[model samples]
Target: MKTLVIIVASLFAGVVLSAPTDSTTKDSQENTYSIKVSDHGVEKEDTIIIDEEKNIEIFQTVDSDDAEVVEDFDAGLEGIIPRNGDSCYVKPLNSGENIPPAELKSRLESSGSENVIQEQGDKDDDLYVLAGGPIKNRAVVGETIAEKCEGRNIYWLTLAEDGHQDQGRVKRSCYLYYCSLRVYLGKGRYYYHCYIVRYLC
Candidate 1:
């Protein structure tokens, strides 16, 4: 807590101190703020741009995804949805539509999002999921994950967005140009997210 206060204080002081030295109108409008920290011989800088008129801020990390908002969920394996036996539907299943986790994961396999599971007697595919997050726009989720696929084949380019209970299936499908499927998490507020389907890379 103390360290955070110090950093915040330093940032505030720097901004105020620079106000008089910088006279360009464009520079004042930029509202671009950067903070650099040195700890144990390691130095890192983060840039944050604030748009006062829009009441929004964009955060840019040194070498990571640009997060529009600070997310309260994880982005690892099954970050959006975990691997549990109990199944729930993010969207109303058809009278006979029952898509399980394994099948859903299979659709996204080419995405290179799966991490091998070490369980015995289970075909070595213990767990699989399409995971990455905290990005502002769901539309770019696919684009963002594509950059992380080093040399592996990208079979899936996915996008997950929240679905309001009032929205109809067709409306949602049209929103995503026909989403392949939805993955419900084990338990959490984000269990209602729908993960869009296969856009190969």
Candidate 2:
């Protein structure tokens, strides 16, 4: 009788332990700022949803065929120019004229501008000379002049005839044009134009 009683007691204990215990759960929801992307630009109208269960759902009709999209990130690139530097020899105009760097330097020196500057690039493809200086006379006829004092950003280079000819032609034609820009790095921002004919030789 005692053994039977013990067995019945053990069975009852097991049944009680297996019964469902108390459980309390909490539900949480939140809104996060988000934007939808389209070909035109950025559009923001809805919020991203997140629950206490770590589940996330975003409601948006984004165009997958968009040209570009930028995520949440930041980046950039850097470049610099020397205090005294030269630019690569770009064709002065849209026309054809092959002038040697040495000849160009000589022509610039003759301008008679104080502090005539010439900076050569270390590489062959670099601009051989960036020659410019102050001119005594700011006012001239048919010439473009730049002045930093006046908060002006651009001016023109003067063009005049150089008596030397490149090939069999005694007088090759050189059309002069005025050029100027505001963002020059040096101290002074004035220069005169020098004209020379392009010789095929």
Candidate 3:
């Protein structure tokens, strides 16, 4: 089945660390996105676009009345086009989302997220499919965890990720987690990655 219905639009003037090449131009760039929903063989699609000055509003804000049906459309997407962020997005093929190994490597390197690409000898990057918020960087990730956990009166593995991070007071309290988020941009898709000092409280 095929259908389209644009029900609402809202704007989030986010910080633009950079612009998508070939997809926009100076003073006249806008990102318009459409999503489709299906129920009982019926389909509905909605689109949202906002362009004002240098900031580009891509999705509807999560606080709007339409949010209930939008699935937090703009969650964790601020400052990520390009951003002080950690994920990469790839649009899927019309038929499916499985990525060829070569194409996966090409996209990760080109997306400026090569640092997170997990390749061993000769193979596609160890990319993971998941959803998440953006992390400013490794340093901020550590500090934020420290402050938040400390505030909750939880003894944690480290203070911050920089050199100052205290090893987990209890060896068992610490864990080193790493992954590259490859978000498939289509229906119900989002992508971002992080290389942070993750620890248990």
Q: List model 3 lDDT by residue over 97-185, tens digit each.
A: 23332333234224431111111221111211223333334332233232322323222122242332333244434222222223444
Question: What's model 1's lDDT at 66?
Answer: 23
Candidate number achieving the greatest lDDT relative to the actual structure: 3
Better of 2 and 3 by TM-score: 3
lDDT of each: 0.24, 0.20, 0.27
Model 2: per-residue Cα lDDT over 1-201, one tens digit each? 111111100000000011112223364343332322111223312122222132212222122111111110011100111112121111122112222223322232232322323222221111111123332343321111111112321222222132222233335432211111112222321221222212111
- Badly placed stretches (over 4 Å) of model 2 are 1-25, 42-46, 52-54, 62-201
Per-residue lDDT over 50-145 for candidate 1, one digit per residue giving the tens place of the 0 to 100 score: 433323223343322222221111121111111221211112223223233333223322232222121112111001122332333333223223
* Model 1: lDDT to the true structure: 0.24
TM-score of each: 0.24, 0.15, 0.20
Model 3 misplaced regions, further than 4 Å: 1-26, 31-33, 48-57, 60-64, 68-182, 185-201
* Candidate 3 weakest lDDT stretch, 10 residues: 1-10
TM accuracy, model 3: 0.20
Full ranking by lDDT? 3, 1, 2
Candidate 3 C-alpha error for residue 131, in Å? 22
Better of 1 and 2 by lDDT: 1
